[model samples]
Target: MKVVIAPDSFKGSITATDAATAIAEGWASVDPAAEIVRRPMADGGEGTVDAFAAAVADAKRMPITVDGPAGASVRTSWLLLPPTEDAPAGTAVIDLASTSGIELMDRLRPWEADTTGFGQAIAAALEHGVSRLVLGIGSSASTDGGTGLLRALGARFLDDGGAPVAAGARGVLAIASVDMSGLRPPPETFVLTDVTNPLTGPRGTAAVFGPQKGLTEPSDIESVDDALLRLADLLGLDAQHPGTGAAGGVGGALVAWGARLTPGAQEVAELLDLAATIEGADVVVTGEGSYDGQSGDGKVPSFVAGLAASAGARAALVAGRITADADIGLFAGVASLTEIAGSAEAALAEPARHLRQAGAALARSLSD
Candidate 1:
C-alpha cells in the first residue's frame, strides 16, 4: 500500500514538517512495509517557507533582517526556488505571517503594527534578482493597508507638510499625499490567500478583520476603514476588489502594486506538485491545527481531500482539534489529537505524541 502524508502546521504547537514526519512514523509502525511519502504543506501562512524547503530539493533559504510589526529588528529568510523553465532566474517565496505577522508582536499593536518587515524581505529578494514572487499575505499584524510595505519599497506616504507620516494605521490615517517615483517595480508577483474581502466597506479589511487586531469600538473600525479608503483613492486603485481586505489590507496594497491574488492552497499545491503524488496512493493523510466549518473552504485539508478523491484514494485526516462544525464525512478516516489526548491542553502539550496516535488510528481504519 502507498500512503502520502501532507499536513499544514498545527499552529502554536507543531510545524507541518514535523507533523508529517511524526505521522509517517506512526503509519510505519502499523504498516511497516507501506510506502510513505511526506510532503509538508502550507497555504501561504506561517509555514510557507518550510513547505518549500521540504518539497524542493534545490530550494534555498536566503536570510535577511527587517523591521517587525512592532518596529523591532527581525531576522527572517525567504525561500529561493532554483530556476525553472517558466522562471529562468528563480522564484522567491516570502510569507507575511513569519515576518510582520501578529505573532511577532508581544501585544496587539492595533494602531501601530505594520508590514515593513514583509516588504523589506521582498525588497531583499528583488535585490537578489528573483524573476518571480510568491507572497503569502496571511496573519498580518496591522491594518495599515500595506503602507509599511510600500514605504520599505520606496513608496512614500507623506503628510500635508510633505514629511513622511508615522508607520502603521496611525500613519495611514494621516496620509495627505503619495509618492511612487522611488517605488520598486515588482515582477510577476502573486499574493496567496483565501480571503475575498474588499478594501474599505462593511466586508472590507477594517470592518471585518480590525477587531482581531484589537480594534473594538465602532468608531475605531470606522476610522480605520476611512483611512484605508483614502489610501486606495490616493493609489488610484479600486478598493472593493476581491481579496483587497486580506492581511489587514496588505492584499489591497499588493493589488495596487500589480499583484495577482490567488487562492493560497491551490497555488501552493501546484508549486509543490501535490496532485501528482496522490494520483495512485492508497491512502492520503492530511491535517491542520483546526478542522472546522472554515476548513472546508479552500483550506489545505479540504483541498487535499479533493485531490485524493480524484485519485481514488482514501482520504484520512488528523487535526489538532476537530470542531463539531467540521464535516468528517469528507474523509474516509478522521482522528483528533484533542480527543486522543483526552483534553485540548494535553493535546497541545505534546502534539507530536498525539499526532503519532492520530496516524496509528488512521492506519487501523485502513484495514477495517
Candidate 2:
C-alpha cells in the first residue's frame, strides 16, 4: 500500500517530522513493502521553518540575534530558500512566533512582553537583501496591538503628552500619534496568519485572546481596546480587517507595512507541494496536537484531508486528544479519528512511546 504520513507538531509533545516518522515506522511494521512517504506540515506557526527545511533541498539556516519578547537578547534561526528562477536572490522564511511567541514569554507577566524582537528578526532578514519575507504570525503573548513590533520597525508611537511612553499594553492607551517614516522599503512581504479576527470588537485581539495572555478579568479589556482603537485611528486602518486581530494585532502592523495576508496552511502547502504528494497516495494520515472544530478552519490537518479527498484517497486523523463534540464531518475526506491515551501531561512525559502506540493502532485500523 502507498501511504502518506503528514502531521503537524503535537504542540509540546512532538514535532511534525517526528510524528510523521513514528507513523511511518508503524506502517513499515504492518507491511514491510508499504511505501510510506513522510511529509511534515505546519500551519505557518512555530515549527514552520523546520518543516520547510525538511521538505526542500535548498533550504538553509541563518541564525541571528534579536530582542526577545521581554526585551532580552535572544538568538533565533530563520530559513533561507536558495535562489531560484522566480526568486533569484533568495527568500526568507521567518516564524514570528520564534521571537514573540507566547511560549517565549513568562506566562505570569504576559502583559508586560512585546513583539519588538519579531521586528528585529524581520530587519535582519531584510539586511540580507531578501525581498520576500514569509512571516508566520502565531503564538504571541502581547496584546499591545502590535505597537511594539511597529516601534522596532521605526514606527514611533507618541503619548498624548507628545513623548514616548513605556512599551507594552500598559502604554497602548496613551498613544496620541504614530510615525511610520522610519520603515525601510522591502520588495514584497507576505504575512501568513492562522486566524481571521478584526483588530477591534468582540472578536478582536483583546476580547478574544487577551484572557489567554494572562488578562483574567474583563476590567483590563477596556484598556487593550482603547489602545487598539488609538492605533487604528493613527494608522488609518479599518481596525476591522479580517485578520487584524491575529497574534495580538501583529496582522495590523504587517498590513500597515503593505503585507498580503493569506491562509497559513494554504501558503505552506503550496510551498511544499503537498497536493502533488497526496494525488497518487492510497491513504493519507494527518494530525495535530488537538483535533476539533478549529482544525476545519484551514489548519494543516484539514488542508491535507481536503486535498486527499479531492484525489480520491481516504484520510485519517490522529491527535493527542480529541474534543468530544467536535464536528468530525468537517473533515470530508477523513475516514476515522484516533486519539492517543492519557492527558497532555502524560503524553508529553512519554511522547515516543505514546506516538508509537498511536501509530501502531492507526496502522492496524488502516490495514483492517
Candidate 3:
C-alpha cells in the first residue's frame, strides 16, 4: 500500500519531520511492503520555515540577528527558495514566530513588546533582492498594530514633535503621523495566516488576542483597541477587513503594505503540493498534539482529510491526545498516543515511541 504521512508538530514534543519519520517507521513495521511518502505540514506558524525548507528544493536559510519579543536581541533566519519560473529572483519566506513570538518572552511585556525584529528580518530579505515574499504572521507577542514592524521597514511613526515614539504598544497612543515615503516593499507579498479577525472592536485583535499577549487589564485592552482603530484611520485601512487582526494587527499592517492575505493551511498545502503527493496513495495519515473541537478548524488533520478525499484516498490520524468531543468520523482510522502509552505523562515522556506504536496499531487495524 502507498501511504502518506503528513502531520503538524506535536508542540514541545516532536516536530513534524520527526513525527512523520516515526509514523512511517511504524507503518513500515506493520506493512513491510508499504510505500511511505512524508509531507509534514505547518499553518503559517512556528514550523512554517522548516516545513518549506524540507519540502522545497534548494531552499537556503539566511541568518540574521534582530530584536526579540521584548528588548533583547535574537538570532533568527528566513528561507530563500531557489529561483522558480514564476519568481525569477527567488522567494523569501519569513515567520514572525522566530522574531517576535511569545516564546521569546520571559515575562510577557503586554504593553511594550513589538514586531521590530520581524520587520527587520523582512528588510534583510528585501535587501537580498528577493522577487517575492511570503510572510507567516502567527504566535506574536505584542498588540502594537504593526507599528514597530512598519518602523523597521522604513515607515516613521512620529509624534507631534516629529520624533519616533516607543517600541511597542506604548507608542500606539503617541502616534501623531505616519510617513511611508521611505518604505521599500516587495512587488509581490503574501500574508499567510489562519486568523479571520478584523482590525478593531469586540472580536478584534486587542480585545480577543491582547489578553494572551499580556494585556490582562480591561483598561489596557480598551486602550490598545482604540489605538488600533486610530492606526487604521491613519493608514486608511478597513478596520473590518477579515484577517486584519491576525498576529496582533500585523495582518492589517501587511495589507497596508500591499500584501494579500490568504488561508495559511490552503496556501501551505498548495506550496507543498500535498494533493499531488497523495494522488495515488491508499491512505493519508496526519495528526497534531491534541485532537479537540478546534482541530476541525483549518488544522492539519482536517486539511489532510480533505486532500485525501479529493484524491480518492482514506485519511487516518495519530494524535497525542484525543478529546472526548473530537470528531473522529472524518478519518478512516484513528490512533492516540494516550491510548497506546496508557497515560498522558507516559505519552509525553516518550512521544516518538508512542506515536510509532499508534501508527503500527492503525496499520494493523487497516490491514485487518
Q: How accurate locally, in lDDT, is each candidate?
A: 0.92, 0.80, 0.90
Q: Ten-residue segment with the worst summed lDDT in candidate 2?
A: 330-339
Worst 10 contiguous positions by lDDT, candidate 3: 183-192
Kindly list the per-residue Cα lDDT of model 1 for residues 1-368, writing each as its tens digit: 99999999998898899999999988888988899999999888888889889999889999899899999999889999999888899999999988999889899989889999999999999999999999998788899999999989999999999999999999988999999999999999988998989998999989999999998899999999998998999998899999999999999889999899999999999999999988889999999999999899999999999999999999999998999888988798999999999999999999999899888888877944
Error of 2 at 340 (Å): 4.0
- Sort all candidates by lDDT, best to worst: 1, 3, 2
Better of 2 and 3 by lDDT: 3
The CA lDDT at 165 in model 2 is 67
Candidate 1 TM-score over all chains jointly: 0.98
User: How well does each candidate superpose onto the true structure, as a TM-score?
Assistant: 0.98, 0.94, 0.96
lDDT of 3 by residue, 82-133 (tens): 9988889999999999999888888889878999999999999999999999
Estimate candidate 1's alpha-carbon lDDT, on a 0 to 1 scale. 0.92
Of models 1 and 3, which has the larger TM-score? Answer: 1
Number of colliding residue pairs in each model: 0, 0, 0
